[model samples]
Target: MLRTVNVTRYIQPLREGGSLPALAEADDDFKYVLKFRGNGHGPKVLIAELIGGEIARELGLRVPELVFAHLDEAFGRTEGDEEVQDLLKGSQGLNIALHFLSGAITFDPVVTQIDAETASKVVWLDSFISNIDRTVKNTNMLMFNKELWLIDHGSSLSFHHAWMHLEERAKSPFPFVKEHVLLAQASLLKETNEAFKKLLTPEKLQAIVALIPDSWLEWPDTDESPEALREAYSQFLITRLNHSDIFTNQAQDAREALI
Candidate 1:
């Protein structure tokens, strides 16, 4: 079972881009970043964040633990303003209080301290899930305690829905480069594939799919069982794994070049 702690409402606003409301934690003991889900967008994005975080941990990635949080109705309001009640209305679901990775720096693809081998593996993982979040500009990766940590998986597997309508989606295949780090240092690709197969079982998939808030689904009137959703996701994983050889080959090539 995942452990959770009660988070206080007191937080400082982060002056950063994005419509999601963010705040810095008051207590220095653990750096807790609060992100409020946009009511208008429903809770699909938040659900993705939660599920992805858990899956990453299962795959041996250094992902910070996350928990659901209830936002006080007056969470973002200034000190004492009665009229602001409605402004903070309809806020709910999953407060991700992640452990702060101290002295960590974002990996830059252009001027990277990480070797080509490692970079290749990271890219392969991102591609496997079709994650567009960890691009050159926003590679939400951090290095702490001499280890790499992956954060912000909100953007992965998003295209699962659009695959039905989009024609060119299959053209851009997943990349499997030889200079990947996983191939050189560890068989991360093989391990991740195995883990994924184990976790994508019908039972596990149902549990994960059930975690998504009902409000996020497109057709609120339609009754979709968690089991059905899980099966769909399972198929998706199987499809990706079937092409695991591509990533492995890429990692091998990259590793050989470095040696």
Candidate 2:
């Protein structure tokens, strides 16, 4: 389980992506960008963030530290904005907190000379998870300390949205990789796929899925319990791992056009 923190103050909201995430101060004296369950996307986004972001880190990619924040309804009472108050009130309990990268700036591929391998690894990871948010229009990447850090994985792992179609969708290739900001610069798609695919063992996948809070996994429509959903996610990842080549080739083809 990720470290749990108590949110002490409700800072202002950040209207970055579709989700209205907010900056808040926690008990640990650190600020974090909090993704609330009350948002339109709901708890599945949190589940994706946990599994997708952690999987990226375990694969040797850079990611921000995650913390499970405990929110008190009182914070909502203090918020002046009616919209934010509603958001806070709806998310009175647990939320995902991304450790604030205070001075980090949004990554701009135009000025950055990213190495081929690094870009490919990121593109490969995005393709593997079927993330549609890493396009040139919205990279979901930040630069801090002269290094790129991936963020906002709430949109990854979309197969989980419908359990009935998950397996079939798992094997489908991600065409959106062509829009990935790094695809043009990525040169080692096959090499990165071969190297990192081994890291996602069944045990490792299970462990990563287990980190998601049970509350987030329980959907009213799904008959599968949290543990069952976790296992399903693990299997989906394993299956997706086997199907990596198709997407890797797609990335390579797109890279050719871009370069």
Candidate 3:
């Protein structure tokens, strides 16, 4: 289980995100950008951030530390804003806390020189997760201490939206990957494939999926239980990894056309 910290203060809202995540102070005395399970995208997005961000770290990407932040309803009583109060009240249990990177600047691919290997790995990883957030316009990357740090994966794993056709969707090709920020500079897809193909085995995939909180898995509309949903995501990632070469090739073609 991830280390849990108590949220002590609701600092401010980050209106940049569609879900409108907020900054807060935690018992750990560290500030965190808090993403609530009760947000518009719901808990699955948090699951995606957990699963996807961990995978990126396993593959040696720079990702901000993720911790589970506990919210107490009493904190809501202090907030004067009704909208933020409602969010705090609703998210009275566990939520996602991304360690606040105080001076990190958003990465602009045009002005930055990301190495081909790292760029390829990031692009390939996004393709695997079907993350559509890292475009030229919204890279979802931060440059801190002169290194790229990935963030905001609340929109990956689209197959989970329709679990009945999970396997079919997992095997389907990705057409949106062409616009990936790293695609144009991802010149080492082959090496990236060779390295991670051997790394993200079924056992590893299962372990990563298992990290998702059980509470995040249960939804009224879904007949599948929490464990079943975990299994579904594990299988989806493993299957998607098996078929990664398809998108790798697609990225190479996209890169050739762009550069």
TM-score of each: 0.66, 0.96, 0.97
Per-residue lDDT tens digits of candidate 3, residues 1-259? 5789999988899988887799889998999999998887688789988988888888888899999989886877978888877777878888898899999999997799899888999988898898989998999999999989999988888777656777777877777888888887888988898789998888888888888888898787887889888888888888888987887788778888889
Q: Which parts of model 1 have CA positions greater than 4 angstroms off?
A: 4-6, 15-17, 24-29, 39-41, 79-88, 109-112, 115-121, 160-172, 175-227, 243-259
Residues 177-250 of candidate 1: C-alpha lDDT, one tens digit per residue: 33232334443555544555565554554455556544445434446664555455556655555555555555
Q: In order, what is each prediction's RMSD in angstroms?
A: 5.6, 1.2, 1.1
Least accurate stretch of 10 residues (summed lDDT) in model 1? Answer: 163-172
**Candidate no. 1 TM-score:** 0.66
lDDT of each: 0.53, 0.87, 0.86
Of candidate 2, the 10-residue stretch with the lowest lDDT total is: 160-169
Counted clashes in each candidate structure = 10, 0, 0
Ranking of all predicted structures according to lDDT, beginning with the best and ending with the worst: 2, 3, 1
In what order do the candidates fall by TM-score, top score first?
A: 3, 2, 1
What would you estimate as the lDDT of candidate 3? 0.86
**Candidate 2 TM-score over all chains jointly:** 0.96
lDDT for position 47 in model 1: 54
